[model samples]
Target: MKFDKAAGENTLFDNAEFVGRPTHRIDGPLKVTGTAPYAYERHDVVEGQLYGYPLGSAISHGLIVSMDAEAARNAPGVRAVVTTLEIDPLEKGMNNVARLFGGAEVQHYHQAIAVVVADSFEQARAAASLIEVEYEKGDPADYDLGAAFERLQGSGEMDTDTGDVEAAFSSAAALLDEMYHTPSQSHMAMEPHASIVDWSDGDQMTVWTSNQMINWNHGSLATTFGLDEDKIRVESPYIGGGFGGKLWLRADAVLAALGSRAAGAPVKLALPRPFIMNNTTHRSETVQRIRLAAGEDGKLTGIWHEAASHALPDGRGEDATAQTPFFYASDSIRAKHHIVTMSLPESADMRAPGEAAGLMALEVAMDEMAEKLGMDPVEFRKVNDTQVNPSNPEQEFSDRNFVECLDRGAEAFRWTDRNTAPGATRDGQWLVGHGVAGAYRGALVLPSGSRALLEGGKLVIETDMTDIGTGSYTILAQTAAETMGLTLDDVEMRMGNSAYPVSSGSGGQFGAASSSAGVYAACMALRERIAEQLGVEEAEFRDGRVIAGDTDRALSELEGQIDAVDSIEWGDFQSEYQMATFGAHFVEVGVHAGTGETRVRRMLAVCDSGRILNPITARSQVIGGMTMAVGAALSEDMALDSGRGMFANHDLAGYEVAVHADIPEQEVIFIDTLDPVASPLKAKGVGELGVCGVAAAVANAVYNATGVRVREYPVTLDKLIGGLPAIG
Candidate 1:
């Protein structure tokens, strides 16, 4: 709450101010101590809650011929047995892109078919296994994306171009064309999707669970149930991890609500570990094609990106072209998506969504082009750099220091270790290489609102925003405390309740700036009221009190009267300014010549998120995202069983993610910057910056070590061994 007197933007205060200081996450203790409860464990609200266990289909795609609950009903402690026929049919949630349990037709493997309610969790599980159901199986569309991909209609969009690409390629002195593929991925957050549903006296209901976006889900759920929005309350105090999986309403919520209403008691439901992959959502798989043509000077004249993907019949496009139009300066450029309908579980957003997958392909392509030109990849990008977005020439960037990021990273990573030729650097049995990549993510802010109370000098802020284990509590505390000119403890922050004003929940890396701005707006209102009550100029208000020429009144004295006024709200400033974050990732790697195993030796990242509300939390966000990117580049993939059309490794043991040992000594640095156009605090989102350009750095390192070209994700060992020239 304290700012260095000389620098106004050094602490947690007003303007595009107080962005460079380091602060701690406001909600750390509650998360580490196990005191904060997740979804189904809300033992505080529902007494004698009936646990509901869901049963999934054995076949990937099929029709439910019939279901018999006699055995389940006869099971011990059974309270109720429900299926599609018995429970009130649910309308699809607005947040759900694909229909939830759409009609009795099973869409993918392990689709939940029925639920059993019992006195205890053990009883529910045991009884659930007793239900008998029959399915009429049918051949499912397999995960043969490679074979199936070629047959795509090629109709949605191919993204062909401005100046004739044929002429550009024919006349160009340098050319590079290649295809890249990335396998499907899972969120795999620590806490699985869960929901606890309880009914109030008549038509009222309350649901406590883990979700990233509360306001959207609240409205979506209300619309789905055809109930009054005020009658339902949703609270998600802390989320284990959402990635992108928890962005929408998972089946657990809809089923628990149905089960609770039927059992005449509160119902608690959690998706079993194995079912998590198929029951909920996962990142969509993509195959991209990159074709680039450059002149003798290595200036790109033509660049085209065509991305193909599969999803449920009505699934949304991943739009991997986000960074393409802004990456470099080119006269002719093409970027688009070709989507196909496949028999599979729903695929939605993950960490960086498009940027995560797009950068993997684009950066690697740039590296390959750099090698062909015998140019340093860092310098290659800088030479063709763009100061403004190519697609939107009118809306220039607020600040683009991508060149400095690359330069600093190269110096820190010691670029001299890497030579122009691959397989030229070796240390014993390891092929040593150093690589660099540019990271970019745009910051977005939507209108967000919050309500606060000032009682006896202690300030309390309330909003439906969720902490989501992303430091929502701490950043919010900083906002209020700074606004009121008080210490961190002086601000009481309440979030994760739908009874409060609507909010911009934690997703798309907008949570910090957008949500805190809502808190800042409300606090500004409080300051004005305090100034009027103290009979002083609004600009003169300071330090929990106000001053006039000869008069002084404590801020607390006017609070009682101001409390009688209506709650405060904020206006939209996101419209005027372009907010975004930029960074660069540099890496050193070692490749085993014998086994082709890729190991990270060292990593460093430089970021330019507008502000740093809490340095401790911001560092954690960067590290976590960097780790995920490393997984995407090195070893995390959801292997699919083509014949069954199901995730071959449906459980955690089969699906691999980054563990502590997988990460090297990682360092993150933030370049201090502020944007008055964004909000009073000027903090851009830091949640997803860690992952933006990571895969490219790893891919570049692999090429440096062995001179092999790989466009597939995870950069598996088999890929390298086959391309090697008889390595002994």
Candidate 2:
């Protein structure tokens, strides 16, 4: 059935036995025991598979004058060397801005220029170092953010203006205008971008890669290689993690396929850690300036969120203000984004693209505005909450419980006992304080299809959807079990193969809701087929038994196997209602008075993202998001070398993510809500929403502890040391 209207009271969902239970990941044991086969580890996948190592350009911005691979080609065990200089320039994918294998003109530092195939990984690595290349610097690299800011231009499509923001600000009783900066960040997934390619007689190629979107990467590979879509296939059943890094086709797959063709054998390639940083995409650096106007009663009158971020010459800027227009209620609001063209590495989505960065600025500004009005941050947010779109009052939100989220989070975090005055609460040499921030991420659904087959009392579901450690296998199992009245073990799940039906393919935090909805559609068809065989109009299956009004039989007693395939398409509800996920974050922090060190003592998140499909997996997602946001608040930043135009700290040791010791006890509470407009499942995504306003919450806590307002990200000790009260 097409989901064109509100799913008014789904009796199946209400009667579900496992849909909302805490089901563990189905692939957990395989991953925990180190039996899960990653792309590079599949050495036995093809006969005589070769190893390929990519060589990146040494210079950042330059023209490749000449390349000499004779010595490397003649070296030991070298099967073939494919250089960009000799190969035709490949077409850039639709989602990509920079060409993965640009021959002469290099767009950024560490761009792949060649790949060497050899008998072993060591031989390929050693031979790669022998290839000599000559480069001539083209022009001064545009690495300065300030310089790029001067050239910022409005993205005409993303710009939104409702009323006179200036007039509202001028008449407001309370106002604040501030500038904040967020530096470039890396995905830093546990597994690197790796691929293994095998080609057949007809030039039909199969790529076993670690990617998030299967169909999207397949289309990209076909486009890049100038092959028909049917000739290329992509498979990625299990992903260590993506965090939006593996959404598009990267060089690993392309280079592996190209090297395999050159060497006349299957090839495998895994990008080194350094190349993962400079060669692949990273989140762009942003300079945001937010202006908030509020009344004496703490109600917002106007809000202006304007941000500028650096992207490549042909790259579209990050939509840093995408969440502002709908997050809070304001009479006059203007949200604009400016794209600054620079020579930096291409920018793409990471976690919650617009909302993550936008809230880092907007939420903190909300706290500041509240302080200006002498009100509590939670109270300020509750007062400004809107059930309708702030920019377009005619559009109503399908469901919004932002105030409840804030109130619940405050109560769970024990806000009433906290000291509002800075440095009033202390333990020995540490000063303690609390902070709160609101979270918002829009809900989206895509056309997704699935196939379900029943044989010997067991059902198998197949789709191209991927599980990037977000528990796709388990949630889908629960969905199928709940729909077909079977145990989790009775459902066999198969996915991440191009042969399966196309799915949404796990990105933008929409994987769980969209993919499961597709599964539901397929299972419904199977139920109908089963009922027809029993000669009944309606049937209900419970615990391996099918029951119609008068007829009942065990599933195994059925005469033949049943199979069905179906897809869920977008409906009119999406056009009529504004769908979004809402949550609130509360944090308690302690600051060392002497050394100016800050530590998060506790964190609690209250979310209202509709129908927690699997409590364990959903909670895990929120906890992971909270941990990542802690890194963004305290230590994550990729340093830029303007002179060399490369990321200075390209390795994991230099790039600091939050360690286990850095994290505190975290609590996640899901408000029992079912948004009928989201999908047949009545569930929305909570992954990105988990990180939405987390950083601002941590930053606000720091301000309450040390009385310092740090506008930049990774609120380091240096920023707080200057304002710390003199040590006793």
Candidate 3:
């Protein structure tokens, strides 16, 4: 049962001193001591900044008959009131999936129609309520995903089929077909999208905002405001959390810029907690059908996953079936995408996107097949291990450790002690169960670059990748320090600024790998520069300096000679091999005997991503993802009021999240491995790994515990009350 290989077995990154070592976040002191300035927290940047408050629509789907801003403008401290009809089109944001409000048409409830600028935040918010608008309300379809989703002409490179799934299932010896629904989920990132915008000296603009992708905004905001990209600069070094929400332009960022331009002064805007749910983006709910065809031996012969999600009228599908085609090998496989147009809030990327929701159904199906075949779920998946993408048989995995991940995880959890029977293991009033699901995430690489400055014998790393509390600063520094053989204190790292070199921009779990690779490239450039400074006839490295035939001086001594090249830049690494992160998530849970609430008892994850730049921070990313999946699987769902087309449970008090009582002790392991294909440092993304399969494992465990299969999300106790067997 012990599947952990020796320390040197398969690891690519764990062998290095700095790679596996546990290091505290380099920005920890500044953040904990309140020195790190967030977007709305910076005071010296703009002295006369006004607060902007957005007025959301009351009607979900409607044409505005009239908007009266008289009362709003008359309110205390209200300076300027801009409504959708009043604001003319500067332009649209290129990367924005949602059409931001303007021109008198309500797409969804709480769509921003007006921004009330006032001297204080509270004053602006109070005045926002005074703006009245007449609407010719139209019928809204919110809870009706089944009907609205059929309109999708379904276009994308996403759909494919190897062999006919209908034919395979019809002839298969065993089959499991089921439907699963995941509800709309809010990112609920602690930092509720805030921004401060100020323009200066005729054409130049500077903004501070809470966002994970800085380069993206540089272009999107410039286009949205009809300005040159070079004139607009954004900076935000410390972000609370994004969970994939801050990857694109949110309302605060846009509204602040518009308000600032109109008021002829800086403006500050942060969506009210009540308005955050509807104003910004959230993950779309998915109704996925998973059909599995297996032989008598429990080996899957065919896998079919079809998912349809509701999106705002102008939006694209959530693409929830992205990972289904390649997850496991099968003779026949098909994955389909369907988008349904609706008048609901815009659906944007959440952590793990397609894979997270898809696995909630697929993993549970694998578990069900294990139940039907009377085989251990772990054993069942291993039996059908696939090395190549079933949909594209031509492309094989560069490295797939999922099989070993499950083997090692099962050994660590003592999974053999688990019984396949429902209502089997119990501790007095508590029912005990263990369930696990394999985790699969595609490796993705994005174009990124970083700038390095070697001055005063210190290495400075600069990239525009926003940290978002992900320890990006610490990891990038570690990578630089490793390459240069410098100590942590000797390396200074700066990030989250448009002025810095463009980065991959911190989403899709690609920030760590992509940004660090850029840093690695910069460091290599520095080594070459140092060699030139030392006048080294042949390439040579020595004690923070270079030597030309034993004639070397301290790197600091070359400061006077290196006027033309104090800082070096590097780019154009996109043509390299595809960089991707991979991992496995395992979960265990308990269902309350009478209440039916599912609680995660413990969790384990094994990641085989190449060299981890910072083990401590990477594991933190993994655990954070698991925490989110825990809520998504059990208690998190945005309640939609169909008649109004608005999220009813608007406040934090009503929306349940996983607290300390909900989270169990979690263990993570990294199979020491490096991919030369990735980059010189050879690392992979771990941000979204913990999110991938944690939910389905818990849901599958609840089934193993109580024998109830409730597919609609939030697995509330009421849904399980009637299904629980009579207790002793």
The C-alpha TM-scores of every prediction are 0.93, 0.98, 0.94
Per-candidate clashes come to 4, 0, 7
lDDT winner between candidates 1 and 2: 2
**C-alpha lDDT of all candidate models, in order:** 0.76, 0.88, 0.77
The sequence of per-residue lDDT tens digits that candidate 1 reaches over residues 1-728 is 11111123523354422333467665767667877778867898868688989887777777778788899988999888777645444677765765555356777777777888889889989988988877888775666666655776244545544556677778888999888888888888989899998863567888888888888888877877788988999999878999988988888887777778778898989998777888788877888888888887888988888787778877864656667777677777777777666777788788877888888888888888887887778888888887766655555665566777777777776776565567777788888777778887877765577876788777888888887678888888877777667667667888888888778888899888878877877777777776666666744445766667776766677646353112222234333334467788988788888888888888888887866777778888998988888888888888887777778787788887878898869988777566554455756787887898898888888888887878888888999987665542
Pairs of residues clashing in candidate 1: 9-18, 23-615, 26-474, 443-580
Instruction: State which candidate, 2 or 3, has the greater TM-score.
Output: 2
Give me the overall lDDT of model 1: 0.76
Model 1 TM-score, 2 decimals:
0.93
lDDT of candidate 2 over 1-728, digit per residue (tens): 69988888777788788898988889999999998888788766678889999999887877899999998999899999999899778998768888899579887888999999999999999999999999998788666775555455334553789888889998999889898888888989999999999863457898999999998998998899888989888889889899999999999998999899888889999999999889998888888888898888888888888888877777766777989999999998888788777666778879999888888888999999988899988999999999999999999999899999998988888898887987778888898878888999998888888999988889999999999999999999899988988899899999998889999989897998899999999999999999887899778888988998878888877777799999888787588889999999999999999788989999999999999999999999999999999999999999998888889899999999987898869999999699989999999989899899999999999888878898899899998898886631
Worst 10 residues of 1 by lDDT: 1-10
Model 2: how far residue 206 lies from native, Å: 0.9
Tens-place lDDT digits, model 3, residues 1-728 = 11112113323234454655789998999889998888888888878989999888888887888988899889999877888888664466855765575777777888878888899988898998888889998874556875544443334544877877778798888888887888988888877889998863467788899988998888888877778988999998889888877887777877787777677889989888867688778888888878899888887788877788878766764777877777777888878878877787888888888888888888888888888888888889899777766776666665667788888888888888885687788876778777888887766766677877878877787788789888988888877777665677878888899988888888887787777767766766777777766667654443565556767666666664231112222233322222345566667778889788677788988887876677789888888888888888889989988778888888777777777778869999888576655544556788887788888888888877888887888888888889875842
